[model samples]
Target chain A: MYPWIWRHLPGPLPVRILEAVVLVAGVVALLMFVVFPWAEPKLPFNNVTTPQ
Target chain B: MDPPTEVIAPVDDYDDEYEDYDDEYYEDDDYYDDEDEQPAPPPDSTARKTVRTIGELLITAGLVILLFVVYEVYVTDLISAGKQDDATQALDDQWSSNTVATDPQREVKYDLLDGQAFAKMYIPVFGPDYKFSVVEGTTDKDLEIGPGHYKGTALPGEPGNFSVAGHRVGKGAPFNDLDLLNSCDAIVVETQTQWFVYRVLPMAGEAAGWAEKQANPKCAKVSPLGAPYDKTVGQEIVLPTQGEVISQVPHFTGEVPAAQQAALMTLTTCHPRFSDRQRLIVHAVLTMSYPKAPDFVPEEMKES
Candidate 1:
């Protein structure tokens, strides 16, 4: 479904942007949910005050 | 490894034969068999090869973790707390000295606009022995006891830009909370002689050395009650003109409307704590301004 959407969207330019957004979001969500929390306090720059 | 069984058997047979043959037979056979049994225990296991490699990896990991923890917990807090303590100790020592303790002296006197302010800032939160002179209307260099008055600016009492600078961490971070100052908090400037009260008025970026220009605009004759001010306009009250200056760091410098000129007491410190990419500015106003009363005076400075 995603590949189809990437190939044909309402606008050619906007579709590329949309595709980029999806890629970035995937990376961020992966880091936050899978990589980061698992790393716990050991994560880089996680020492100081963190978001409650 | 144990000797072959055949070799040990022969040696044992020889001994038995000697025992049966008697002393004469032993004397005839001149060969001596005095070797100790139970060969020296095999050298300790050669396991260090693996252990060394593992040890190195653990050490590296431990170092990295330790550095991260220290930076997070101690570096920032220690710097701030140490600085505060130093400032406080400096004040306490000043008061405890025989000069201050023996006399009834009032170094700081009262005033409304520029009379009563922070006569001096003593950060007790820094450390036990850390202290620096806070000259009335002087830069960090003038203090001459470590922190100095900033070069090329007005003294706290005179006007213009009553600029001061101190460390954010190390050498007793006197201005660590500089970033946290809100739009209107109290910034009192008191001196051993008198007090000069002022309000905070941060400048916009591009206006100039805004951080170094925190002073009482009321004393400078710039009016918060004067004509309506347009921040974009190049207006002058008493601060030095922003020369053709370029900074390695970025700063905010918008002008304060004439009406808001007397609304703040600005303070600034290096931004992000560890990086000098920008400055953390806090704008505080004068809340309470009064002289150190005779009773409040340090005895050392009092007249005999």
Candidate 2:
């Protein structure tokens, strides 16, 4: 999986490294802001309030 | 493949890469390196490729769930702390702009807009830095900003319960340490005008010392309840369905008896941290309320 990602990141050594960082950061941001918050209500994990 | 001088690939061009390793390993084997020593089996064998695919699939699944856990415990806290700070800052701005209304004679009405910060709660025992913005609603969205006040419950210093709900494990975890509070620890609430100081009631097995506990300087002003409320303790665990814990008299019904309706504050959070199967509730009774004064800090309000 990691090698696949490494392979897809285009450019020379320095440029590929920078792109990989950007790609990882983008994934983290998406999970943090959109995916996780959207999934919060659907998941039963952090149900703090009463069922009312 | 080349002059022995160029045996190693430049490490730059991708073509001559593992192609050489393949040739070197399999040049001799037909089945094994010792047998035909054939060219490194095309890139990778079907078996090796399948194994890699399965391994990657499991790793991807594991990482996604791990990321979700990280979002729940750490990411959400980061997001919500920023939100809580904003709410607190807005409330501070509003409070600072208010003209003095220090009249003990007249009644003061606290009208809190939905989702707005209406009060600030502090657990003196939790230390001076333990304050949280008390917003007006208990919905998840509202709580993401700070501890939320349960709607329809009493407001601060009122006659019934001023119930609040906060996350126990994440989203700022305003009540993460709630269980640590023992009998008679003061929980102070600051509104526009008054500082309502409350003290935790006796815990289940500690009620026998209610009188002795009240003798503490911090508890001196916190009076015990009568009848319907005499049994309510400082801490309890109730199922998520027990909404009655926020009633005018927790776990009790009937029109509130004027004498029995003690002004109380209830803090509810998910119990057994990181899980929400039950609720851990902390109940405190109003001990005293004084008009806000610049130099007047409550004795129970300690930094640490």
Candidate 3:
């Protein structure tokens, strides 16, 4: 069972770590750029001509 | 075999019987009786509490409405009371000076020049009584009168545009029939001063030169061009500039005009009376001016 688990593993340890790190960074970026601005009242996001 | 015991018959003494009875039993009975005499709480105490709460709520609501009414009526009056006192004092002074003895026709200053003062308007013919007021920024306040002028304006008697606006339906509805003013109908401003009569000049279609609509033939139409056209040389038109004539809450663009417009009186209101879709504008020219002061000459009074 141990040999089977090792054989079925998708990638090296560094690759897996990079994937996890990228996923968490994307989520944090989405929250900061989209969620926080839309929710907070004090932000002047709507007044700007561009979406940013 | 039983042990032999001496049977001594104890005497039934009254002192021994009294000693056997204890005072604690009587004391406990008396305490229970006292507890029973006290009354239970009434079941309707909650109802009484509820009634008191509702009464308090009603008093609070009444006080809020009373305060609103007081603020609307008496508070507004109190704020304007100082201005009113100043006007009354000025009127009293004007009366004592008998200034009319010199000019015989001095203009009276109208304080608190608001739409509220002009509850209605009258023109004698067409619709004799229409309501109008000195709407803020939209219309001329009491200061704009006659060939004479108020210092507040851009220029004194050299009229570009001197206009006033008012409501049509609400607040006594001055200019209710403003659309009905046609050519040749006499417009009269009845005041402490003489009745200033105005004649409605013919505006051909929507684009007539209304600035040149005064009764005085000497007042000529100066071209829209400035100084190359000398200010002192050309005859003065009494009507205000047509573009400057505005009828809205926040009136006329903040940018003051460079050229001399017409000396004009523009009365306007919301079209269709109540709805604010379109505007009805009536422009008129000063035909005659009068001062309705006491101790005036008979000839001037007849003309007025």
lDDT minimum window of 10 residues, candidate 3 chain B: B142-151
lDDT of 3 at B304: 17
Pick by lDDT: which candidate is best? Answer: 2
> How does candidate 2 score on lDDT?
0.82
In angstroms, the error of model 3 at A15 is 85
Q: How do the residues B1-304 of candidate 2 rate in per-residue lDDT, one tens digit apiece?
A: 4665475445545567678878876755645645454454567778988899899989977987899888888888898899988998988888777655566666766668777897998888787788899998888899888899888889999899989999887788888888899878889999988899888887888766668776677667655566788668889999999988888898886787656588988989988887778899999999888888888987769724
> Taking candidate 2, what TM-score does its chain B reach relative to the real chain B?
0.82
lDDT of 3 by residue, B1-304 (tens): 2333322323445456666655667888888988789856657677876877788779856864565444333442343344334444554564456454346455444443432232112365544332122222232222111011112332112244334444344222445555666554555554444455554545434224545543434223212223322221111122222223332111344443544344444454455543544555555555555545566532312321
TM-score of model 2 relative to the true fold? Answer: 0.83
Interface RMSD of each: 16.8, 1.9, 21.1
Alpha-carbon runs more than 4 Å astray in model 1: A1-52, B1-65, B68-119, B122-148, B169-173, B202-266, B283-289, B295-304
CA lDDT scores, all candidates in order: 0.40, 0.82, 0.41
Would you estimate the TM-scores of all the predictions?
0.38, 0.83, 0.35
Residue B207, candidate 2: how far off, in angstroms?
1.8
Q: Predicted candidate 3: interface RMSD?
A: 21.1
